[model samples]
Target: MSRLLLLSPLLLFLGLAYLLPLSGVMLQSVTTPEPGLQNYSAALGDPLVWSVIWRTLRVCLCVTVLAVVLAYPLTLLWLKGNTATRVLVELAIMIPFWLSVLSRAFGWLSLLSNRGLINSWLQSLGIIAEPLTMVRNEFGVVIGMMHFLIPFAVFPLASAMRSVDDRVILAARGMGASRMRIFWQIFVPMTKSGIVGAALLVFVFSLGFYIVPTLLGGGRSVMIAELIYLRIFQIPNWGLAAALSALLMVSIGAFLVALIKRAGVSTT
Candidate 1:
């Protein structure tokens, strides 16, 4: 078929560039250290590995939730606003998505540091004699990640909200449904797919984050990606690094499957 021919280039590219490298990693993870599952077994038994994985999942979940909450109101504003306001709001969201990841990470570092703008303003206001610690911690990582992910959440949420039929809302309002009731019952339910899609997008990307977490986490909150980097570059533990990568890939696959199942079963 023409479609099959059209897909050949992408298939070839993935096979050569992506799949080949992943296969190498998979092979290296098991075979380089005497061809057994010992690497995986050790990684599973290590408490540190579990800690890093849990931290990664927790941060990603926090970022996903925060992004959805932050983006939803802005999405509503954009939906209800005049043409000019909507365009400006859209531009604001798109700007961050367009900017470089490292640039945003450093910007967050500058803003969250003890001598940074936020702390300086608080100090000037006499909020506290001692500057509160903000940077190089889990909080800073969450902030940076939310900054990166909010726009991604916004676009999909906005599209879902837009897909909602305005006439249905008006009809509900006419039938004496409260605005809040209408929104809760109608708007949210209709947009579930978009919300899930956006959340999944944010969650997946957050799990794989390197630059933001590295800059903001101050080596205190070790994520899986950072763990991988440390293994490969710092300790030169290729077998362990490959094992971690493989395990992470499997975990991601399982998580996605669980999400799909949950989404399917949920009626409300």
Candidate 2:
């Protein structure tokens, strides 16, 4: 009874803040502009919608793979490096959290645009006469999303890596296991949970990204989130927008459940 009383305020808050809005979205998806599942059927049947879904999935997969590949080395540094090195690595991961998403989007624009610093430097060094088209495309969107997500991937990986038993690694070395052999055969297997957790975290995060895709993609790279915006504000198709929102919410919820299950297993 005491615990129930203590939790009542939070339950009420969630009911108002989350459950209310979600219920509205789900209801709107079916009931808005007339009753039925027409919105969902229309969304699933459209070729353009399928294309956007495919593009979003592709971008998310690319970002997740890149984050895992890049974050592994950094995770290793965080675990094994000296104090100063670890501090620098941690600062690099954390500083972005202080900046606004809009600010980071513009920062990438300045560095990646055709007339940006990178192009200017390359041209000055006679690397190429023509500027590279980096922004306003899928390439640009992937780069921006990856930058935002790598830090998220790193922490999970670091947690997983920290749980690994060092004695097992040393024992492998004592048996004349090469560094590469031990890493591949022993280190990676023990840290598989972290890698899986990080990949899922990054992929799920990439799914909901709107600001970076809108700015960096320059209207050419249309992701599902942007499509939802277009359906809502641009075209005033509330039913379709609500349907997309509900679908995205359901997908993310499924991922969150998987993530929780993974964490529980890791803890056990």
lDDT of 1 at 191: 90
Off by over 4 Å in 1: 265-268
Per-prediction TM-score: 0.94, 0.92
- Candidate 2: where are CA atoms >4 Å away? 254-268
Specify the poorest-scoring 10-residue window by lDDT in model 1.
Answer: 259-268
Give per-residue CA lDDT, model 1, range 128-225, as digits (tens): 77888898999999999999999889888888888899899999999999989998998899898889878887998889899888899997888999
lDDT of 2 at 133: 94
For every model shown, the clashing-pair count is 0, 0
Give the per-residue lDDT of model 2 (tens digit) for 39-135.
9999999999999999999999999999889999988998899999999998988898667889999999999999999999999999989999999
For this target, which candidate reaches the highest TM-score against the unseen true structure?
1
TM-score of 2: 0.92
The candidate scoring highest on lDDT is: 2
Model 1 RMSD vs true structure: 2.4
Model 2: pairs clashing at backbone N, Cα or C within 3 Å: none
